[model samples]
Target chain A: MATINDVAKRANVGRGTVSRVINNEPFVSEETRKKVLKAIEELNYHPSSFARGLASQNSYTIGVIMDNTMDKVYANPFIYEVFRGVEKSVYEGGYNLLLLGKNTYQNGKLAVERVLQGKMVDGLILQEQIIDSEYFKNIEQYNIPIVSIGKLENRDDISWIDIDNHMAGYMAAEYLYSRGYKKIAFEGVELEKIFARERYEGYKEFIGSKGLSVMEANELLQNIEGVICLDNIYAYKILQRCKKINKKVPEEIGIITFDNYPLAEYLQPSVTNIEIDLFQLGLCAGSEMLNKLRNRNCEVNRIRIPVSVNIRETTR
Target chain B: MATINDVAKRANVGRGTVSRVINNEPFVSEETRKKVLKAIEELNYHPSSFARGLASQNSYTIGVIMDNTMDKVYANPFIYEVFRGVEKSVYEGGYNLLLLGKNTYQNGKLAVERVLQGKMVDGLILQEQIIDSEYFKNIEQYNIPIVSIGKLENRDDISWIDIDNHMAGYMAAEYLYSRGYKKIAFEGVELEKIFARERYEGYKEFIGSKGLSVMEANELLQNIEGVICLDNIYAYKILQRCKKINKKVPEEIGIITFDNYPLAEYLQPSVTNIEIDLFQLGLCAGSEMLNKLRNRNCEVNRIRIPVSVNIRETTR
Candidate 1:
């Protein structure tokens, strides 16, 4: 039941000073901030999300737009990890989270708009592909800040936190070639998303630079070989079909995929793929969004999430 | 782009009737409901979460209390699936989501207070264990509606949607016994949560009912044999320690865990376990919570999430 006035009085500071410290405003001196924090701790003061949202208009709440309807894949795990990282930082910074939508539904934009126009959240973290030009066009009308998880090819206007997918692709191809596997094939979404194109570019560049001919057939398109994709069940189909192709994995042809999913290892041949640092990506995105909310920085933002290749039994 | 009035006029219903239908009021007749639905479909009208929350003082947003800090485990693909299910219904219901915190951080009443007092979310879907008594006691003060993924023991007053852990445990034990395994053990939390107790009870009942004398040493503490779990991590530590302890899994003793984690398969002799219908659980929870919210039903509550045993290479 202890109020802010009680903490302010006990901390020997004005209510405004206490509010400044609580808001994490930089104006309060370090000594005052410490005293205020100590007093808050002593009082066990829990700030309400609405009150915070009202006072600062910085709900610290980020609108995460995920295509939840997509099949649970390695890419999803990566995204989830990134979400964790972002959640960690957002919580530490004292922010609430607003999960927008699972990309399959068109309602995600409505969720975002609610937060934007209704003043529910401060900023948004969009992990979904901006395929709906109309959605984006409507979104562009509002000045609500957005930090897309992955970079978009044509939409350079939006801010995004992404991994160096191009470099990851190059590394995978180079690593496969170095391991004495020449006929390396890449698999995953062939969408215009930056990760896909960047990965393809990296894979092709690495192979071409080595004077190795990258076969056209090796480039698997959005359609996987015999994989049955039933609304986000891509991983199983890709693995099952790969088994039927009479292709000896790693021995005859090495395969690399973008986004490391959980079932990756459980697969028959076990997939060796690049793992994007989704946690760090989320953390960076959350932090950047927080920073933007604190200061209306409208400049174009692009954050690169780190990637690590999991050398598994699949690659031999 | 179409307004609610436009839809109402097209459907030949009052604007209030359209609103009631959109809000999912049960009083609307099926004929009128279909008309409103057709109008909505034809118009492609989207309801914002804020408008819905403000109009009814119900955000249609649920606070998902999950142990996100824990390592992503393979054994519990249900978590992801449940999340997907929750996403499906909640999104379709035009509700947003907010992941509250991991078990420890949101440990006691703080989590409940945040959700209840803050009024950020209309209802809570506790995805984690409800172990802390003080937390529950504090939560009772707010009078906010709650829908738990796990059971709240000894408190029949609250609403929750959970898996039949006892049945799941009974099934697992019976499966092991039927497979001709004489000695078997269950691994889970040593908390006040209903799941841990139910699973343990089931394990004991099945074994004792069979006239088999179960040894106490066979039961692993909160820490499973060979796993050094401090904060839901060190999952591989258990398998590594098993290697050190010379307790060959599925050979000398059989193991069954409650929640399936990710790295369960990577270990030699992948774990045999039951999978909670997390998606169904989530969907049901959302559906039930929304129903309760609308009807304010007090007497009829409590939903048991169905579970299935996933027999992998682990069980002998």
Candidate 2:
């Protein structure tokens, strides 16, 4: 219920002084600033965000653009963890988060246009795996700072944070091969996805270097000793297929997957997985976006997050 | 890239007229509205959201207040599903979603005050199980409409949507009992939660009515034949405990749980569960909130979503 007038009266300053203090403008003296802050604390006066935004020409809010549909995003727990990470960083930076999705608007163009033209958010964090060059062209015209969560194609203008998927796959294959498994297979969906494809290529490279042929479905009869699953869902499907064929896990076959999902631990034979810190990925993207928004000369342009393998029951 | 001037020129109207049309202000004739609409569509001039918000006094944005910490919300798949439903409904209504959390701010009070006093969002959807009365009082003081996802303790002024936990529990108990399992146990977490307590109470009522004693942990030694888990996570834990004790699933024990999580189908014995339509629950809450925001005298105040039983391998 307290207003700017009350704060000004308590702090013994004009309304404009209080406004400047609230907006963090560098005109007020230290003593005056301290007095105004104390008065604000005492009055418990929360300024209207609209007024603050209009005065400062900044909303103190970050916009998160999710490229995936609601169903896909919700179904994959990875996205949730990433969002949580981004949210934590944004909150710590004293900024609000606005979720903008392509599926939320009539088309992807509209979604991008809304964010670019809104002039409501200070920065943007994009979580699109495959970036459209045309969309980036539109975003480039704006002065808004952006950070992508995954590697974007044909974009060197903005920063991005992602894990080394190829390294993850190479390590997964090497771990299985080191455990005395000769026949190894890679299971994945959406071969067109950059991450999935990179992982598969890495697995193939490791297998080829070891002078071992990649096991195909027909070769399952000849004993596929190890399977590198692209993700937890694929790992579960592989387990189901093994169960159907009466192939005992860990005893006759070993499995390693990406993204250590919660269900992985609860499965009968807990899955071994390459744990890419999804929350950390989100946090890094958010932090980078904040950095860019604060300092246009931010030096860090690209960041690669590391991945660790969680050795569980499935990998013996 | 299209400007308001272009739209006005194309529509043969003044810039102010174009602005009024975009803001949906009255006094613009029907024929003029059509011309402006056509012009806007052709030119693809997306107005600045800040300008639109200032002019219309509505942001067309909904704030989702979460009581849980970011980590907790991210870990729970049920929350994700509910969020998906809310997102779907909000998107269909052409509104953006802003996520605000207690942990995001210094405290719950600050979080509530920020959302209520910010004047940045049109309405709010609260997902907290236990809301503070003081916070609700503050929210009530504001003209902002609110919709709670769960049942609140004291206040009935705001609308809420939730599943019939009592009925869900009763049905679970009936199913286990009908399977000729005399020794039945109820497993739950967070007894403080209303839904959990209601479920436990329902299970107890059914057992007492049948003249059977509720089995305790010590009673498990005397052959507890069936276990009704409060949720999927507890169900996973129960299975782990059973495995540790060398009790084979289904043949020696049967289990049923709430929330048919994705892992439930992939679990070794494939958990039987009470399938609460979490998505539908979210959809109803979101739609109801939108209706209330548009119409002050919304007919529906409280909505109870239905639940069904998914008979899987564990309940045989």
Root-mean-square deviation per candidate: 9.1, 4.7
Q: Rate the local accuracy (lDDT) of all candidates.
A: 0.62, 0.77
The residue-level lDDT of candidate 2 at A12 comes to 96
Expressed as tens digits, the lDDT of each residue in A1-316 for candidate 1 is 5678899999999989988886677888899999999998898776655555545545556677666646543234445566667776666655667665545342444555644555666677776476346676666666677777777666777777788877887887777777777654554546555566677788779878988665443323222221111111333344444556755555655555655555445434556666666668788888888777767865888877767777765566
What i-RMS does every model get? 6.4, 3.2
Q: How far off is residue B212 in model 2, in Å?
A: 7.9
Deviation in angstroms for A257 in model 1? 4.0
Considering summed lDDT, which 10 consecutive residues are worst modelled in model 1 chain A? A223-232
Give the CAPRI rating of model 2. acceptable
Task: Calculate model 2's interface RMSD in Å.
Answer: 3.2
List, residue by residue over B28-88, the lDDT tens digit for candidate 2: 9999999999999998778766656655677778888655453543357666667767866
Please give the lDDT score for candidate 1. Answer: 0.62
